[model samples]
Target: MARRATVYQVAERAGVSIATVSYTFRQPQRVRPETRELVLQAARALGYVPSGNARGLAKGRSQVLGLYAFDMFLPCDLSAPEVGLDDLVAQELDRLGDVRRFPLYVDEIQRGFELEARRLGRSVMLGSGTSRDSLGSIDLAGSVDGLAIFPGGAARDLLEHVGRGVPVVIFSSPPMHDPLHHITVANESAVRELVDHLVEQHGHRSLAFLGELAAPDIGARFTGFQGALAAHGLPVPEEPFDSTVLTEDSLRTLRAAIASGDVPDALVCATDQLALTVVDLLARHGLRVPEDVAVTGFDGIIAGRLSDPTLTTVRQPFVSMGRLAVRILTDTARGLAHPTSYVLPTRLVIGRSCGCS
Candidate 1:
């Protein structure tokens, strides 16, 4: 039998480091194009067969990146208020069509991760998440090398499972959950910008945040709002000024604020969907937007533009986030030093809702 060619043999023949050879095969971006091509040509010339089995044995899985939502429903419907973050993800996916070819699949929890297994070409698989409960779908992830999860209530369970060997990256707004890589937004800066826009540019002193206060984002945004109020010498209320941390409760809190005459001149929502809902709800109460209560939302989505008065918001760049997740997962699979955390910037988009140009 011919001697089995090691990665070292491939590296020597291709005139590249073992890392370059690995990068050439698994993550082409890390290796220079010319070097990657040379390595590939040398691999072919040596009649070297890259053994998926051997590779799996060496790394414990193929170069499959797993992405999961905590719930299967997040993929198909974003309007469901209980899972508003899913709406943010939906907007992000819309923009991610061109970055890389690694296909994405949403797990239904019915079949094994069949959709992902077939579409991925040494690719990344996004799962709903293991936050609320074990995705039982994890059984299908034996072929995945790493996972990017949007954590929920059952995050700890999922974290424990991924600890079984697979590297885990958490896509969230955070202070870095230990042992899990995080990709977050500049939540504080973005929220501050929005508050500044609402208070300074729009000249609205009375403001409200429509979101779940339990979510970490709530604290960051609240802090920003308070900071803006302080900067402008505006009063920061001592009570809950229309804050709801859970998605299911957001509309109710907003509706109650409207009824109680406690509605702010400008309401900044934690998400686009909430802002959209506020628009509809306010209109139902016979109030004219901007003329009555200017509103701002986070996460720029298609629906935001179609609203009666287009929403002004902090666009979280979801597509960019998805693409970044893929890049990180792919690099990690190739044994590269992926950045410990990635925090993307957000932009304040002006629109009629916030009475902006």
Candidate 2:
């Protein structure tokens, strides 16, 4: 077997130092164009392929970005009793086949990360850390140049651990006092606008928020919900329909609420996924949407568009957020100034579900 060509051989053939050959591959901007061309030609003639490990060692960078989400790939809980499917709902779900296969929000963000990373000459490494054990187990310190984290699944201790060694950008979560950077949506403002639409346009006085108030993002939405109601001189509901995810438990709770004759004029869900489940559950109980009750959701996911009464939602700029995350991480890697926190804007999407034309 023939021995593989080395950087030394390429340097000798190109009449350049070994350091120049390394610089040509790792930091071409530092090498002159003519010298770079000469090194490339020699490498091509020698059939030399640069080893990623060797390049990383030389440049002290992996040229890769790591994306960590806790529930990005968690499968939907399909344990609810089978109700007769609505034609529009079925079609919408079918069209969003990828959402069904993976977590919608995470998948959309990943798509954005991939596109921007490619343009920046970097690759993405995706992983899920749904629990403390899993979050603490990943070895990300030396594997990538920078990291983007969802931060919902991991604890502060775990985040501090990984972030101590690399630059990290958090997504969909609030900024902490720690040195880690953040890229989050305008959750409170978006929810405030959504609630204002419900009250001012539709006169939905009796409204209820459905979400786990303990969660950071959900808590922010809840704050917006309360603020909007307060602005309208309406009292906050005694209790919020609490559920972290749209599961059978959430369905059962909603059923109980309906049975007790406590159904509100409008149901404000924290996420589009939750809203989709609520709409389906309401249909099963023979409640007409936007007629008997109005419904609104955040995160303008694809399924929301295809519902029988299309969901009224705040369309989060997931793709743009992903791109921004990459840009911040890359900037940090390059010793450039980047914002410690960013709150991107969201737009209200009027659909029939919110009783809008």
lDDT of 1 by residue, 115-219 (tens): 333444655444453444574436435657776666655556656677466666665547565666777778878888888877777778777666655656656
- Candidates' C-alpha lDDT: 0.67, 0.83
Worst 10 residues of 1 by lDDT: 99-108
Candidate 2 lDDT, 1-357, residue by residue in tens = 788999999999999999999889888999999999999999999999888868787678889899887655434433334556696478557766544334488778989999999999998887765656553325765588888987776777777777778888888878778888988888998999999899889988888888776558778888888888888999976457655565545556678888987898999999888887788888888898989899999888887887779999999999998999999999998899987888899999999998887
Q: lDDT value for candidate 1?
A: 0.67
Error of 2 at 202 (Å): 1.1
lDDT agreement of model 2 with the native: 0.83
Candidate 2: misplaced stretches above 4 Å?
A: 1-49, 77-103, 134-138
Q: Candidate 2: which pairs clash?
A: none
Relative to the true structure, candidate 1 has a C-alpha RMSD (angstroms) of: 10.6
